[model samples]
Target: MESPRGRRQKRRKTFFLPLGTSDGSYKPRQRAGHARSRQTGICQVLKRPESATNTVKTITGRLKNARTNPSPKIECWIPEKNPSNTGLVILPGGGYGGLAEHEGKGYAEYFCRAGIACFVVSYRLGTQGFRHPAMLEDALSAICAVRSAAHDFSVNPGRVGIMGSSAGGHLAAHTLVAWGQYESDVPLRPDFGILCYPVIVSQGPHAHRGSIINLAGNDASPELLEDLSHEKHVTSRTPPCFIWHTWEDSGVPVENSLIFASALKKHGIPFELHIYQKGGHGMGLNAPFNWGAECLRWMSGITGHKTA
Candidate 1:
């Protein structure tokens, strides 16, 4: 992913996070603008998914460090309040190659004001794109990492959740199924999922090619397709979810969330689905949609948090 500054951006030399310090050393994001002083250099370079023994189940996918050296984990946003026994990890959308910063960091800031700690997961983007599983690995590892360090992070690990849009939304869905089905060391599930105009069912132009291609890998095997599709793998206990989409979207079809909602409905799992007449895909939570009131109200109802 090209940095926003690109070459013109003054490159800050690697100095904050030690190259090989084990995980759990970094502190959670604090309210106000204070950032962890230790990891001051490069942002957290994805590392191999850490092994977990009996962590709670939450969100799916896995993330690994791409670089041989570990960089300091960067806190893109500051929390205005403390963790409210519940926290959220955000995976912003970017078609598996790059992350939409506006979607990721800007969205996480909402959790802060609402008194929920948020970890904006910057998973490894595909350089020309990595395998489908690579993004998944990073996503899952991030959730587990937060869960694994719940106490240190100032909240209850049991109530962690994940949210995202577009490609990220799809990963949030895929991760739950992966945890229940895979043998990965990281915990494979999320307690709750909030998908904003997710790209769940991929069969149209709005269908995320990067998502499909990444999940399928180069050969494009049938088994891989089956594995990455979250709708097909949904179980009775796939966790509570809150989903929303707009009919106006030309990118990822609304049917993606519709199918996911149908599956959730069939499974009798607790969920809330809000199909808006406006607000196209990837509107960034607080966009100029008239239904902002409805969306926020719905989110508060589902998560039981107040986001003002």
Candidate 2:
């Protein structure tokens, strides 16, 4: 087999191609108070199945219909020089209500500067009346899209990983464990995971109630709750992970990361866990600690990339 660096050298320029769209005219809404960063190069909206559209009543007693629902999309970014053979799919946290541009676009820019290709996923949200498998489906789809087109993005297919913050971290952990349960043409399992202050418990004192309720509804079943609690789902098949959380994260308690890391240990999965002494929730790339640098170092070790 050719070396991964050799594959990077043959990479073509990246392009925005709709993965599962028909008309190819879907445009995601811009969340108020969050500006789109210039670092996000181009976006491609992936279409969901017709069955994905179901009228659901949100917590606010308002009806959300397919006409108003936004499909999942991916914003792509590729480095201009000496790109590494690694790709990352970012899932930003919004309590399942919105996407955090800083976690999405800001992370993309930071990682791209280190010669890593990035894809920021705008996944279906609970506030938008999506739930459970919908968010999971979108996450898997984004991974498949990036891996399937790894050459175009100048990354090795086997080096693609998933990263999420807060609720997005929950989704990333869920994807890591539950990917084998879903069927897909291309491999849907991420090679690794990077979780930042994720919400891991779905039905406990440590659970972020807003995220649990938004994702599974107030009437979620016991079995569903257990399933959504990603810590309960970790198996040997789950990939290696790099998890970080602040002890001062009041939003999603530090115990969430602890429990998940414990599960990883139980399954004999190699992982790196970082607990910062300070920093509140949603700090993104602006945390007092240099988590980005640490994560880059971890990526280099995993991918064996000298320049990562």
Candidate 3:
């Protein structure tokens, strides 16, 4: 099958709304605000859907990213169809300094075409003065909002999963391992995790230095680095995972994914892992070497979907 970008079809209208505020009665409003960044950017709220559709539609909106004013927001991408009742929330990779825009929606639309609901999340970047807990908080809020608003998005809350690449993968892994430990009235853990060429460690040459520096700060303590070193923290509580990476990826190193997979095995958490010989790093939803089909196939076993 051709990728969404390769196929020609009539584009459908998309919507953007604040996650908690939309209740099927939302009306589109023209408001100027930043788009998930401390830097000023205009983002408009879209009208809520009266009901779900079979075509491609989206709901993009802001979710709280920080505790203070002038903070960033999380952008949630709601797919048009939910026949599978499965939702996947995505976090794009940018080494904690920025977000990979194509990695966000490109993968979301790919899954949306497979009858799965997807939300592309944009968290606060460290370059904007946001730190460890900020990104994790925004990610947790996105998961909570997706679950709380599952009806509005036409997805099964229990089937919700999270996917990420590179640094974003680190955050996704962080959430899966630490969410249960977080004290919140809302459940924040994802049913599963998908990591693509992820940065899984905070120490060693295989780790991405920029990512660790951006997240833990330059003068980070040994305890802090160990805490963020996700491979050491994995346990049985961590959700099942799907991890993939290219063997020649010198930027982040394939060992990052290998070590994490090893920990997952140690805890006996069921997982699927893949390593490609080519396609270096940061190949976001590109053809010929993409993992979307395999990922969907793996998720099908977990969600009881007919197609993978």
Top lDDT hit: 2
The alpha-carbon deviation from the true structure for residue 170 of candidate 1, after best TM-score superposition, in angstroms, is 0.7
TM, every model: 0.71, 0.78, 0.78
TM-score of 1: 0.71
Clash number for every model? 26, 0, 2
Report the lDDT tens digits of candidate 1 across residue range 17-127. Answer: 212212323354432332354321223223222231111222222234322221113232223345335667788887776789777777766666666677787666655
Backbone clash pairs in model 1 (N, Cα, C under 3 Å; residues 3+ apart or in different chains), count: 26
> What is candidate 1's CA lDDT for residue 200?
79
Cα-based lDDT for every prediction: 0.61, 0.75, 0.72
RMSD of each: 9.9, 12.2, 8.1
| Candidate 3, 165-282: lDDT as tens digits | 9999999999988876553333566888999899999998888999988887999899989989999999888989999999888889999999999999999999999999988788
User: Over 4 Å off in model 3, which ranges?
Assistant: 1-77
